[model samples]
Target: MRELTFENVTVRFGSRRRGTVAVDDVSLRVPAGQVVGLVGESGSGKSTLARAAVGLAPLASGRISPAPHERHVQMVFQDPYSALDPRMSVGESIAEAGRRAVDVAGLLELVGLPGDRAGDRPHLLSGGQRQRVALARALAGDPEVIIADEITSALDVSIQGAVLNVVRELQRRMNLTMLFISHNLAVVRYVSDIVAVMKDGRIVEYGPVDEVLGDPRHEYTRELLAAVPRPAH
Candidate 1:
């Protein structure tokens, strides 16, 4: 079952980044029950493509289709700082997910946070905490698929491992179809079963993660692989 499909999608933005296109005539299908990593440089349009898939951004051309019946869909943003309401108590916020037909407590636990963590506010929590809260909210909707847009970008290195592991474990336990977008090839390789490389807004290469990451055919992809900055711990 194809969970999401971007058919001949094109999106362009009037930006100062020369030769940069958001997404250019890219066609992609993320199959059901797998994680797909969308990778590119800062302006590679990976995020733009993800946003379009989730109906957050409109396409300049082409079609975006969600899974049939759409049990639910969630987005875990890269920047946890701006994704949530500072004033809203996590419990209140999560409880609101009741509107999405999910149980708030179950959502919190599913993200690996204690159910009580739901009562805290974004500002009261650490960076990882905030991100988990956001995840809980996203899951609160009991989504069948999630569009994770750099959801771990703000966490500490140690925390990143924990969160990544949580996501990996949950994906299997719950059968989630994940679209993980990032600039880091390492993270992409870690979480993705399939990989898609975007360059100047177009999908230059795509295939199984090991195949594309281990044997990249595009110069841009090789350059991206080479430029990955290792963490200084």
Candidate 2:
């Protein structure tokens, strides 16, 4: 019964007089062992909502209740270089999140990185490799929920698929409840079990991924799908 629930959540930033509303009274449910995609254009509050799930953003009102088992929820940011320590070895970074003596080799293997890479610094690895290390670090927490914010947006197209595959495999094996935030519709559709579309700090459409993406009812959702780039025959 592990799950994450957001009840009438509102997240505002800055002074009330000129404050900006990032997440506005949005309520959503993410059942355990489910990958919920939060998709929207830039400034649509997708990232804000994901950050709030992990307590990175302050809630102006409402509540976010994490499952009892979910004592630690980790986030994998878009920029691995920034998220990771430039001076620390990959193994040290992972161990830091574990808050205990973690098996760095095993974690590297799990993320498809070679064991020897554990001693390398963040700047030495390729963009894709660094991202994998970031994933391993997030996994080190043994989190009940993982918030991935635009993780693939920084990688090359060819590398994006590989990174995504690792995430999908880990989610299935770990039975992780994931809040995947991205502006790419295709990527969201590929990884999400359920989809929540946000626009201007509100969920404009939500449902099973197939239902929402396949037969979108909301005008904004329809427009989003239509805007996705398609290859010509």
Error of 2 at 192 (Å): 0.7
Clashes of each: 2, 0
lDDT of 1: 0.81
**Residue 91's C-alpha lDDT in candidate 1?**
85
lDDT tens digits, residue span 74-176, model 1:
7888998887888888888776765545566777787777887767778878888778878777777767788899888777887998888888888888788
Evaluate residue 92 in candidate 2 and report its C-alpha lDDT on the 0 to 100 scale.
94
Clashing pairs in 2: none
Residue 74 lDDT (model 1): 75
Q: Any runs in candidate 1 off by more than 4 Å, and if so which? A: 14-21, 67-71, 229-233
Model 2, range 57-79, lDDT digits (tens) per residue? 88999888882235567889998
The per-residue C-alpha lDDT of model 1 at residue 3 equals 80
